[model samples]
Target: MSTTDSTATCECARAVAELREELATLRDEVAGLQRENAALRDANERKAERIETLETHVTQEFATIRERTDRIERVGYTAVGHAREHAQWMRKHDRLHDALKSRRERFDERLWDLETGEIDVQDVIDAGTNDLPIQTRTKERKTNPDALRGNKKRSTFIWPEFYARSRKTSGGNLIVTTPDAANILAEAGVKHDNETTKRAMRFVARLSGNRDDPNHEEHLIRFEPGERGKSPARLVADAGEFEQFAREASGMDVTDSENDETDTQDDSDDIVGAEADEQMDTLLNATTEGS
Candidate 1:
């Protein structure tokens, strides 16, 4: 009703209006925050679902991998077992082959002795000459006059003296009949007189076919002296003679057959032996490494 009272009323009205505006602003901020919180909660739920799906897929992949690994392990174990079995088989085969080879060797030696007089002389002869004849002076002259002219001829008188001085024929029992055998004997290159006779006796004994008779014991061929002191050519001739004698005595041709069989057996044994050795080495290495 006075001027001062009116001014106080006006101030109160302005304050009330300001307070209402501030409350309205606060309400709008609260509404915006609530909307943001609801959107965040939805996004979090979607992320949780995606994470669960990813975990399931990873678990399935791991299970598949584990299954495949188990199968591979089983296969590896089976392969190792098979390898061991094969190794054992190879060892057994090698042992049997060796035993059979030994038996075959003994049988061959006995059979060779039975068929021939004592040794497989045929093999020695076959190795030496191939059944070629020994070339003689007369044969050479007949075959090639130029060759005959180039070579010198010794006198018949010299032959007797040479024979007499030779150590091979002490009592004239050793004869140089075959031209080949005679050439072989002369070429032996014996220095000592006693050695010459001994060499001659050995040559003659090889030539003579009296191995079965015991009365010709002194005439028997001595391999040791000739084998030790003889030249390569003489040794070859002697070997040929022995081989010829063996072939004549033995009615069967066993050399080639025996060689073929021996080669086959050797190949088989080599393969088996190699496999067995590898297996043994593997086992030994494993043991050494504390496997």
Candidate 2:
């Protein structure tokens, strides 16, 4: 072989070796880039799943908020309408007041006539001159048509027997444990259902003015741990709460008396006068300016 030929062959061999090294380096770089792209794709998939979960949670929360807002709006509007109707009723109370005044004056004259032996007691009863007098000798007061229409309307809401018999000089807390007490409340139209009792107990608890106390139910009823049916279901209330509930629910006076037999005939006439005066005062107040 020639020397020039041998030198050219060596140079070609060296160039081929360098080209092979460059190709190997390029292949390593391409593999590393493929691994990195795979990792990035997995990260993006996980992030999308998280975003979808958050979207579902937010949608449920928004729906709950909207429902609660609608309920509050309905309750607020109903309360406003009730207040307006009460105001209208108060305006008509004045007409009843005038009629009650005339009735009272006639009652006084009749009583004077009876005391002076000018008229018999049976004649007073038979003549129908003493219809629905604000007295407590009977179990219930007879509804009188002779009274003004407004008076009749008001009477339908409030009971005359309860008003005449149950008014006390002062108020006190009530611990209702007896069946008699329950009967009195039921007769006056106050509901004693489970839901009503729960609401009433909750209200009494709020009267303490503390929101953090969760055991207020304990104060309302003496309960057995395992046997709820054996629990002593008692209604307890402060004076003001009792009066407010009694007047609002049945428009009747609340008495602590456990039985109807406690009422005597001697006090019936006096109760009549006192009840009439109180009724007159209530009528006058309702008719007051801007009432």
lDDT of 2 by residue, 181-228 (tens): 334435645546543344333222322222212134423112111235
The digit string of per-residue lDDT tens for model 1 on 1-291 reads: 999999999999999999999989989999998998999889899999999999999999999999999999999999999999999999999999997897786566446544644333442453243221111222232234443211011111112222223233344332233233344334533122344433333323332322321123432233233333343222121333333333332212122325544234323332343343332232112211210
Candidate 2 similarity to native, TM-score = 0.29
**Residue 236's C-alpha lDDT in candidate 1?**
20
TM-score of each: 0.33, 0.29
Per-residue lDDT for 216 in model 2? 42
lDDT values for all models: 0.41, 0.41
Q: Once superposed on the true structure, which residue ranges of model 2 sit more than 4 Å away at CA?
A: 82-291
Q: What is the lDDT of candidate 2?
A: 0.41
